[model samples]
Target chain A: MSKEWIGKTSNKVKNTVDRLLVKRFAESIGDLHPIFVDETYGEKSKYGVNIAPPTFPRVFDYGVLEGVDLPMKGLIHGEETYQYERPLLVGEEVYCYTIIQDYYERKGKSGDMGFVVIKRVGEDAKGNIIFTEIQNVIITEAVRKGINV
Target chain B: MKTMTEFKPGETLKVTLAPVSRLDLIKYAGASGDFNPIHTIDEEAKKAGLPGIIAHGMWTMGNLGKLFTPFLEKGFIKEYKVRFAGMVFLDDVLTLKAELAETSGNDLFFNVKAVKEKGQEVVKGSVHFRLYDAV
Candidate 1:
């Protein structure tokens, strides 16, 4: 079936890199890279500023609806792809808009399920596109007894 | 014994992951839209059989970016893949170590592993990066 959902989130005014936030994000992922925390080390890098790690964008909660509700269970992460228009620098206010780009139903080995594609675009203060992330999530009903998909 | 090939395995790099807090996990949930209670709510996580709110797999993968930046200057990571193994509990220290696996032409590949304080491997994966010469 051809179905699509679209949603938008406004810009968030962030004056700095939010060390505590970035640090926590890094820590959760078991990251030990000093550039994320050491300002001096980051300053010497090619970016000349504390650059948020590549997956840093995933930390923003834009609240996009992809025809699904919050706390979606049994949601398996199928694939993820990222495209960067420009490098992200610290202390820049940014915003992201998420949309349900596409969806389809398929018959798997177990049974039938649906696949959803979510797209999120992050933009800077000047409305320049910084990056775009596309994630595919598979939604299926929990097995009645002892089947796995 | 010298092998026929001219490839050499790069040095190994180790990084220690510090303890993670609950607040940190919440932020990651927001940023990633992965509101799986197993990662955000401790009570639910415990009920679900996980020791505590576990970190997102992608978040762990992101850490590798720092390791590669020094080698591939002005290089954008074209792709990365990882396979999840064990669970990561809150406040548990983790470690990520990598060794140059091999090189194909100008592409550099590294085999990386993430483990917990107990020495349990949480994830094992490989990353490929494209290198560009300075202008």
Candidate 2:
């Protein structure tokens, strides 16, 4: 039996909260919401600084797994869940830690495969949990002959 | 500011996502720890029966973030959920449309759908955002 690989990622460091980072992200994604780019416009709204979109966490959280390796092919994204404790603010230094929450294998139309769950928690400068996310990854063995797994 | 309670059901909004590239996929993979070869390697994607290197499902869902910009201070987004229905190849013009399905007090409910240029539904699901006083 192949041993299931499990591990944790290191913390990612962010020093200054650059509003431009948010703008660049929004622009790259073709987002035109004034709240994410125009600080003057955002100030007039509820959030004082430019508020990042919900998926913005994707830009910060994945850094935790900087140098890890899980050598396998044919990986599929099964699902994702994110919960926010508070809205992230600009200029707030934050860090994140990632861990393998669970792993299991089963037989399906795809074939005998394994699923790995990863969780990452984001914290503020004060060490408060601001957000948490979990990602499910499916790994399947290589198919043989013309038979599809 | 308009509260979700003010909008009726079946109201739809069209939102588009910018073009994605191989570099963007690599950047997202580094940030999300989802180094799935299908998204980063064209060869792998071809072998998997995909047109080419494709974007991540979350990356596509991230387009919905634009909709919430108009309604910030609503406590950010509380929850966003979706299911991957199809593949999004590189350089594909993607559009996300959401219909206001229901609303209660400060919370707005939406049945979200994403599609490629060919009008194929790539993802479908619901998302809920909490609204706050506009002031």
Candidate 3:
């Protein structure tokens, strides 16, 4: 068990909330909401700037934590949650990093399963917290065995 | 736009998504930076022990947020949560539903979910949002 990772935090990754990045994410989800795509609409809206969709941060990369042995191929995204201080504004620089919140194992029909809880945090240039996303990743017994963890 | 007072608790909203395709998944991979092969190439999916390529769980969850797009001006989504109940495969048509769960002051709480054509829930959760006036 990679219990040592429970308190590990990854290095921060900087992301510019660019317009095109927001637009592409909106399009991929089939949501063409003007607030996310139309700059003019965004300019006139309450936000005064285009905002990324609520789930947009899923795209941001949180730099890797060294020595983590989990395999990426078979891990399942079991659950997700996002807590926002406010919507991410377009063009604002966001620095994000991930922390391993917890880890536990359970028995399942197929085999033993390990659940990893990770919290990814984003902050503004001043380092004020912007949003926090907590996601649960599941590793099946086979994948764990392959890694010999 | 429906004002916070105008929306009654238990009011439900629904959005039916077009069947998901491989092209859509490919585009999502490019946009979201999650290029895990199980969500794209069939061969890679097979190697991962899946029957075939499956859609990214984020793709489906992202679409579920669409149920509240119309309310963006009223308020932004302060919180969105979901549990991935099952895998979403290519060409699977999904239906998203959200029912107003409660209202307090400017905050609106909703119970949301995503279901496939066969009525299987692929994702289900809740959304918490507050009105702009309350900000």
Interface RMSD of each: 3.8, 3.0, 0.8
Best prediction by lDDT: 3
Instruction: List where candidate 1 sits over 4 angstroms from the true fold.
Output: A1-17, A66-71, A143-149, B1-35, B40-55, B63-66, B69-78, B81-132
**Model 2 misplaced regions, further than 4 Å:** A1-17, A61-69, A143-149, B1-5, B16-44, B47-49, B91-93, B117-119
- What's the TM-score of each model vs. the native? 0.64, 0.77, 0.96
Tens-digit lDDT string for candidate 2 (B49-135):
887888888777777555656556555577777777887878887788888887776667788888888889887877776665432
Residue A149's lDDT within candidate 2 is 26
Clashing pairs in 2: A17-A91, A62-B31, A110-A149
lDDT of 1 by residue, B14-133 (tens): 788668677666766765556778888878878766667787767666764556544433454544555666666778777888777877765657777778887888767666655554
A52-98 per-residue lDDT for model 3 (tens digits): 88899988888898877878778989999999999999999999999
Best candidate, TM-score: 3
Ranking by lDDT: 3, 2, 1
Candidate 3 lDDT for residue B24: 94
**Candidates ranked by DockQ:** 3, 2, 1
DockQ of 2: 0.43
DockQ for every model, please.
0.27, 0.43, 0.86
Pairs clashing within candidate 1: A58-B31, A59-B31, A60-B31
lDDT of 3 by residue, B1-135 (tens): 455558899888898988899999999999999999999999999988889999999999999998888778788788999999999998899999999999888898999999999999999999998887863
- Of 1 and 3, the candidate ahead on lDDT is 3
